[model samples]
Target: MEQIIERIDQLWQQFSGQAAADISKLPQSGSDRMYFRVKGAEDAVVNSAIATYNPHIKENETFLSFTESLKAAGAPVANVFAVNEEHDIYLQEDFGDRSLLNELEEKGFTADVFALFQQSLSKLAHLQIKGGENIDYSKCLTAREFGKQAILSDLLYFKYYFLDTLKFPYDKQALLDDFDALSTYLTHTENKHFMFRDFQSRNIMVKDGQVHFIDYQGGMLGALQYDVASMLWQARANLPEEWKNSLLEYYIGEVNKILPNPVDPVMFTIQYNGYVLIRLLQVLGAYGFRGFFQRKAQFLTSIPQALKNLSAFTGNRKMGIAVPEFDKCLQFCTSAEVMSRFEPLRADESTPLIVNIHSFSYKKGIPSDPTENGGGFVFDCRGIFNPGRFEEYKTQTGRDKAVKDFLEQRTAMPDFLNSVFDLVDISVAEYIRRGFASLQVNFGCTGGQHRSVYAADALARHLRNKFKVRVEVKHIEQEAKNWINP
Candidate 1:
């Protein structure tokens, strides 16, 4: 990462003929690409530039080409400044840190947030209608267009990664047949355009009282409803039902003004709902793959909310098509028992307990409690089999699938956590009874990189699920050197 940053700064200087005064990293998204802001520039890389480092050369080219074409069409896309000869790093207009998601979260459901969304959605309608005009489909990362294959892939992604992992009983073949039927129905939508496949608030940058867009590298020729659905029905957003209806209506009205052939308001909306289901299912699949399979805490926390959203959508709205088998699968996935499998029993607002779980190296010693109440639990995790001992797992941390699998299957991690949970449960109950506000739990190991991380995550998960308390898990040594969540 240090090497990438240094190289990117050099590239920025070479392009602009100005040494980078400061270069700061941006938060990483789901993609492997890394972003940085190189300040002290005079050009329209927004007075600086967003330096992007991505290893996928082809993806970089597609993004550059799309940016060129989209900007030419008056789309609100970032202007590309320069691309390195290798096509691995480039600079583009910077929109700063504030995003539409940040604004929505900060402002709540006020009229201000509504207007911002309307502004973004209005831009989206124009981008969809104009951005794809004569654009080269061959540059797309995967499918040239969001055809039936891509649609089915999303469905199967949900089935294989999310549904199959649940160990729930359902007619597999029948469910698949239904998946085909649903995909076919969605693929037949007439209003295809430049689909920003990940058109969510996080990607919509808010700068200088306007909305700009990014992360459309996955864009392709597809339905307008897909992008709209992706944004409004985003599970984590938990947008109001009323807001969803109003915003959808607003977006259609905006699109009608720009579209050569105006969309039928009624039919367009029904298709949008279908795309909404597809978007929800696709998100669950992503959460499963990155959370349940990869052991990422952030994604795991979102599962409960996603399940609730799915169930509500199914219950309240008619999907305009019947797929009994798909509906059966949905019922199973969104059932109370199934949701309970992933959801933490949230403590009442009145409950004061907040568990802080830490993973630390013995060399650095056990993590000290920051609060005035200094005494807390610190358990030695050295007894567990160390994945760090083997060369195969040395580079992988507890967050990786291979290391987590090794720790769970080959080590005594389960039994150790089971014993730990039994001991902690008593104290947690006692603490809540006593109206205590804070509980700190620390796990110590030889290196703090592998065993301790896994144990700390386990304990946090256990406490959140069983005790219904807030849990904050930190990798002490890993975080010290920025080793966590990279």
Candidate 2:
């Protein structure tokens, strides 16, 4: 560690002399690995730091390039100072002593934190790597594979501390079964994107009132929901339920602003639940790795919390189909029914989790009953279904088939008329039957110009008695307005 420190000092010397003075007060690393920050005495140049350790594997210029790209893309990545590729030493910018977690710990985040992260999300959303190749997500293993490692850890932890060390009965097969269910659920992704793979609070640095990322060598192209889940579910910074849902939408809204097309929030959430479950699995593995292998008993205490979160994910209606499998595993490992058997649990019902579904289409299509719309049932704990109506497309030449269908139903148009309706429908259903709490409905039109917007207004009008409707008459050719149904 001393030799590595000296090498890091030499690297800092490459910068201006003022940096040397500020480097002295740096914290003694909490871990065996050494990290120190060297700031410019005047704060004129830039605050910087070095992370040094014996390379368990190795580091290289390619690694440097990855970090550099992250920095350029507005990602909260440290700038590369100098790298001893063989030793895994990194000298980079020091964003200074605030991580997102730190702010939450000390002076709880103001609205500014949300704004700051929004900017960061925007940067990440628009990010496209130069030289055109996307990030190599393949290098990072998937959660399915990673979950197995967690199972092994849980098994070992149970056997050692919980069983042998604590003299408790260890159920091995139950754990294996739970892992199997978790692995399968994680494999089904509704959407995918470049992921920070491990975007936990510990890894996010808040220096100079801005958020940045550290320990990002494990980055990959994966699900967008993974980072959001990590941020919301992080042990150190567990967010309020309202805050979590709001921030989740904020991130999605930011992402949609940059994408060529909008994303389905319901679908993203379904995927998010799966990612959360995977995260729990990874946490279990990490805990096992730390507790049983490293002799750190503190991590063992965290296992139950991880299990609890895992249970929450499984019991989620969006995640219901996968829950039975995951439940079996939980039952197997803990030898106690870990998953909450009673759901729409009283706590969940009282929370009033509201999710709105928005759909739009260009052609004249009939809209589904908002009550039946996937997003409809979110209003009621009991399941509700809305089959979006659409004007039947005419197959016969010059035949008034579509017109005939519309006249028969007396419905003007359909909201969310597009190829992705399958996903949209599923989302609405899940929101009602599973994630029930409250509901809002949105209808869109191609250009929000005509059909979709009109259909949306009608549905809002139809559901006004039971729902507080926000009906938008979006027109591609004109400004949009709300047609509140009385």
- For every model in order, what is the number of clashing pairs? 0, 33
Location of the lowest summed lDDT over 10 successive residues in candidate 2: 378-387
Q: How many Å off is the CA of 136 in candidate 1? A: 1.2
lDDT of 1: 0.85
The Cα error of candidate 2 at residue 114, in Å, is: 4.4
Candidate 1 lDDT by residue in tens digits, 238-271? 8999999999999999999987788999888888
Please give, for residues 200-297, the per-residue lDDT of candidate 2 as tens digits. Answer: 66666776666666765545555566677777777656566667778788878877776666788887777677667556655666666665565443
What C-alpha lDDT do the candidate models reach, one value each? 0.85, 0.49
Shift of residue 202 alpha carbon in model 2, Å? 2.4
